[model samples]
Target: GNRAEQKEDLRQLVGLTAGSDDKALLADITLRRASMYLATADYEQAVKQAQQATALVATHDNKTLEARAYRIWGRAQWQQGRANAAKPLLQRALRLATAAKDVLEQAQNYYDLGQIAFLNNQFSEAQQLLHQAIDLFKVEDDKRNMIRCLDNLGSIAILSESNFEAALTYFQDSFRMCQSIHWPYGETYVLYHLGNCYFEIGDFAQSQETLGKTLTLTRLLGDRAAEANALDTLGLAYQFDGQLEQARAKFEEALAIHDSLNDRRGKAYVQTHLGILLSNLEEIEQAGIYLYDALSARSDSGAKETTIDTEAALAWLDMARGDSDFAQERAQEIAAWLQENGTAGVELPFQVFWQCYTVLKLTGAAEEAQSLLQLAYTQLMARTQKIQDEDLRAHYLESVVYHRQIIEAFEATTR
Candidate 1:
């Protein structure tokens, strides 16, 4: 369905219904119009249209219509970043829908509430709400929303805790459902997430294959944003697997696409990746160019990773430039910050410690270096203990370059 075409059609119908004697029908159409407006991100118009629907149903005995109106208004408010204003309206709508026995409306309300909780970082509450919504969606046979719920649940499993196994289950469920519906767009979206997860879980072969499929689908669908994402993530898969040239090519492709789309943030992200990759290749000048550009872009955009990643890359650049003392200082600061505050569900601290360990060992600090490496390895071991899946645990140990490197480093010292 072409959303723009549908919106135009609905607009025409709403025009025809203006001043009609049938108030309930008009209210229904208006509420629907409000939803179309919301879909197009016209929050002001969506709220206005919803208000009209509410006014029409004020003297009418139509709880369902009132619920619909309130839901639209609440969603509009939420989209406008007015969560406080949205919550009460959504609750009121849910109560009305429940009283009217509107199962679908109730599920919609639950889904919205779940989204709110997710955005608030209340993952536990979000999971419970999404589960309740999924139950109702199942009853209604709403497979589209069901897929959406599963994806959100998978994200919660990952973001709240590094429950990669559980996240994989949820995403696989979504992929299957999307396949059943023959929805290529949904399948493409799912594949991107699956690829990232596979990379995180250290299944590089699977990650590359999944991302290859994602690239093919995104090309077929002409989804440039998705295409750029696939390239960037696939580049990371190659980068982590020690294929530096392949990684650089993919990063360059992704950067070009981002430039074409004028996606400043995406450009910054890929530039930073390219900088780090170049640093690993010992191309100090090229790495510096990309790193400083990324630093500026991220700073201007207020991207939080401005300090963490770009600074880390710059430290690597310093190491590649043979400035061991400067590299050690910067690496220590970055590693300390990561150790104290942690990163967003990544083992970044380990990578920092691993890099700095070499500098320490070379600078007559072998004992300290070994101790630092052991501490990082201990942390990695603790995380692996939490993963119940045997195959995933094995993959993390064997396929993850960082994990494998640290283990080898620790063993060599003992030998």
Candidate 2:
């Protein structure tokens, strides 16, 4: 509801009831209003209402309601990407809920904490916490919360573990449950994750198909953030499918939305992707511009993975422009960083390694080229096996074949 409608309703409720005497009821209503504000993405109003609720409930010795208020406040912070700030509030909620023996609130706190852990890239901790929430939700017969848990678990599987098959199974189960419950919103989330899993597994066709549904549903729901994310993933699907023009259009559209929203992280991510796509298309000058811009954005955002990815693209662009010495130096720096920081099982690092192989091969650094080619070939082969679709598998295998051809050519020339 709008603020005016909510205020009018609250006024009527207070007038009809005994006003200050109904402290518990007022606190409950305030918490509900806070949740409504949170749902509308009004974090400031949500936090304000939740604080009011907390004050009201504190006077009445209502620990459960106070815990609920804290949870709402923490959730608002989490939605604003302040995971660190949200954690202590959620933990306090959990502590209070545990003291009150409020099983459902405890479960909710666990789920929120799991989300924080996932955002922090602590996948094992997230999995453990989510499993706890799922178990508690199942015990309480909370089907909706269980579905959310399953969806998040699927995300952890994909983003953390890189287990696309397992992630797909989780998403499929969650999707079926959402359908059974007639929850279109839940279904949309499940489909979005399914699309991402398909993309990760190299099934671009299915990825595009699923993301198309997600985009349609997000549009229907009028969720700009969801729409932007769907478009971003759809762009990746198109890019992987070799549809460069379609990919560029999708990326541009997503970028425009992110820009309008002032979502710096989203803009940085999309910019990195666009830089990579332009590099692959051999638009060297434009690619260099985008790559450098993306690098700056990622660095500002402290997005380490994306920063490395943009740097890799820029280095590759240097090589494409016949600056082999500069490219080699950049590639060596990136290789050292990857070794020290680890790749986090992401495909970008492997793509960087492939570029490194190309640079070394062309620069007549046979020993370095052979070593990097072997590493890239192994990683590519492993990734190819994850693509269950035969055509997609073959498409992905072409990279491995190219790597082999380069290696063979090198051996022949050297011999």
Candidate 3:
């Protein structure tokens, strides 16, 4: 907590110093402070500083500095949930960098584009962009941003497509690069990502072990946000491993940190996950209340995707309460929203399938239920079929149970 305050103070000092300085120095200081903010995950402040830096460059007329400033500014904007605002700025930066023949700056611009694509859940596009950035980085001998790009690619592979093995391979390569460069923060970042891949693959044991180390390292380094993230991931592993008590503890701790730090999105995420665990324990009313709160929080935080998920949870709760009509209504609402908005990745599809399955089962439409199940299974398998192996195959078993439950329910209804 004390360290967090101290870091904020440093951030303010840097911002003030950069704003008061002349063009060249201001640009340099702003970029440096933007890097600091990125490390601290204070993306809003990073964007502010980057914008300030870009404003200064209009007076100085330095294309290279302007390009770099725009790239960083665009990244910060994307991270701050303004991807549309980021797009044109990043495109301008890329064009400027290319025109200036600044290979490294051009590579960094590509790296930022990859990040934007990843955030928008464009996995294949992100991979292609990141690979291009990596090649550019190698040509320019820029190992640092190259490794960062790799980590981003790894994250997309894990979360967007559930390609855990590919994600792990990327993390391993990133870890090797971080080790070769003796980058402490980079090492922790890679470890955290590796843990996520392991978690997604159902290797809770490895996830727990790696994330435990990451938590310790982040805490020792006084990185509050990173520590909170690691704790949250650890909590998730516990949740999936059926360690409800431990999961609750970890989640409570993480929720406290997010609340204290005023991270609304983080709070919403933990609240939703904690609500799920509570529901699993048959604490339905309490879970419903929490899930509703989580839904509102997610909406306020502009986490529209998570808001949809919490809606699905509410639908599930309604079904569990024997309120089939309400559940069906909510499920239809979600499905309509998903179709209109065209969700970027698999999560939206997953939520849609669950809702459709629930509605079909509740209405005693056995044929439609089986059809939806087949559709979901076919999509999931098609997306991940090539990626699964013996060790990772069990991860898909959850989907199987979901299908089985609907079939069983439909059979019971017919009887």
Candidate 4:
């Protein structure tokens, strides 16, 4: 039985010989190191390890090892917020797994690919991939993976505009599955997401209750990453409810954790959230500082490598300062990139568009704001697939709802 220390040493030894002649051994070692780095939120390092593993597969003609490498590499790339990069890698992994007659590997590939597509706003593609993975998991009698796919599918439905009731159904189904399996991780994760959905549909009480449950579970599990996420969402819930002080406390606590972990992505999230919170409180100076930090990070890291939240935060701050010239410039840049990446209807990034609309409304650019807001509505309304997980669907809904409200307010201001 290998203890933690032994595991650590074994991992380091594998890393040292990862470039050696033993292709199979190198692939396994590289994957292991990638996992270790991912667990610690060292996304770049994980990508490096995954790439090394990928290289070994081609060099040695190790098809089996190559499949695993592609899968791990895709996951690592996704963690770096590069869903576009991850998509094709996951596709290749799926292809390799199918060719090798590895059902489990195929299921994992579909599951990951589905998630990447969902994040990139390709709901139709996400649903298809998730369904395939779900079917495979069912045949393998792997309830865990089935529940995961259900959760993801449910989220996609909630984010998409069409068929809210259907999306809710999926969320319920996913929640029930997690409950039946006694999967604490899924239970908490789902609840956190569900809370967001409830928030989106104006079900503040339910959102608060579910989000609270998620926070409790994540704390019990000692999962700092999930805890931070729960806190951020919970804070947003409180903010929506006019509990500004409580929201601030939650955001601050989340920020502390992200900083301590040195998670750049998490830090970027916290900074963006903090900027938004301060802006809402009318603390213009402090908000400017936080927003600048977020934008600086986003610009330095590359847009694809940073969360949309950071870009949105900076854009909002720019608007708040009446820097319409710069804000519009950024919006144009984002809109072009989103279109180039095949995101339609809402060609502007959701959060950033709302910010841009807000500025336009405030500046009495009613016609322009209305045009953009209509696009958002049209994009959101065209989504019709049902997501089959309660918690995750809820989170997706919540995000949509929050942005929706921003658009609504923009429209109202014009009247």
- For each candidate in the order shown, give its overall lDDT on alpha carbons: 0.81, 0.77, 0.75, 0.71
Candidate 1's C-alpha runs over 4 A off are 1-129, 132-140, 296-307, 345-350, 359-371, 413-415
Q: What digit string (tens of lDDT, one per residue) describes model 2 on residues 1-415?
A: 1345655786676576654667898888888778766764566788899999888888677789989999999998876667788999999999999999999999999999999888777889999999999989988999888999999999887666555667778999999999998877778788999998777666678889999999988776656666788899899888867798999999989989887766665776688788778877888788777677767766764546647777777777887788888888777777666656666634455567767667766777767667665565555566556657676455444433343454454456557
Task: Residues 269-375, candidate 4: write the lDDT tens digits.
Answer: 66777798788777878988877776666555454625455665666777767787776666555544543552432322465566656665666666776766666
Tens-digit lDDT string for candidate 1 (1-415) = 3455677798899788888889899899988888777754466888999999999999998999999999999988765546667889999999999999999899989988887776555678899999999999999999888888888888777667778989999899999999999887778878898998898788988999999999998887666767888999999999989888899999999999887766665777788889888887778898899889877876663424344677767877887788878877776776566556555523244566676676666655666677678777777787788789999999888988778889898888779
**RMSD, each candidate, Å?**
5.7, 4.5, 4.5, 6.0
lDDT of 4: 0.71
| Clash count for each candidate, listed in order shown | 0, 0, 0, 14
Model 3 C-alpha lDDT per residue in residues 1-415, reported as the tens digit of each score: 2446656776777667754657787787778778677666677788888888888788876889999888888877765556668989999999989988998988888888887777667778888989999999999888888889889888887676667778888999999999998877788889998987777666788899999999988887776677888888899888777788999999989988887666665766677777767766778898887788778876664546657767777777777777888887787676666655644543335545766676766767666666656555665556557665765666544433343344454456557
Q: Model 4, which residues run further than 4 Å from truth?
A: 1-62, 260-269, 296-358, 366-415
lDDT of 3 at 397: 40
- List the candidates ranked by TM-score, beginning with the highest: 3, 2, 4, 1
Error of 2 at 193 (Å): 0.8
C-alpha root-mean-square deviation, candidate 4: 6.0
In candidate 3, which residue pairs clash? none
Better of 3 and 4 by TM-score: 3
Q: Evaluated with lDDT, which candidate comes out highest?
A: 1
How does each model score on TM-score? Answer: 0.71, 0.81, 0.81, 0.73
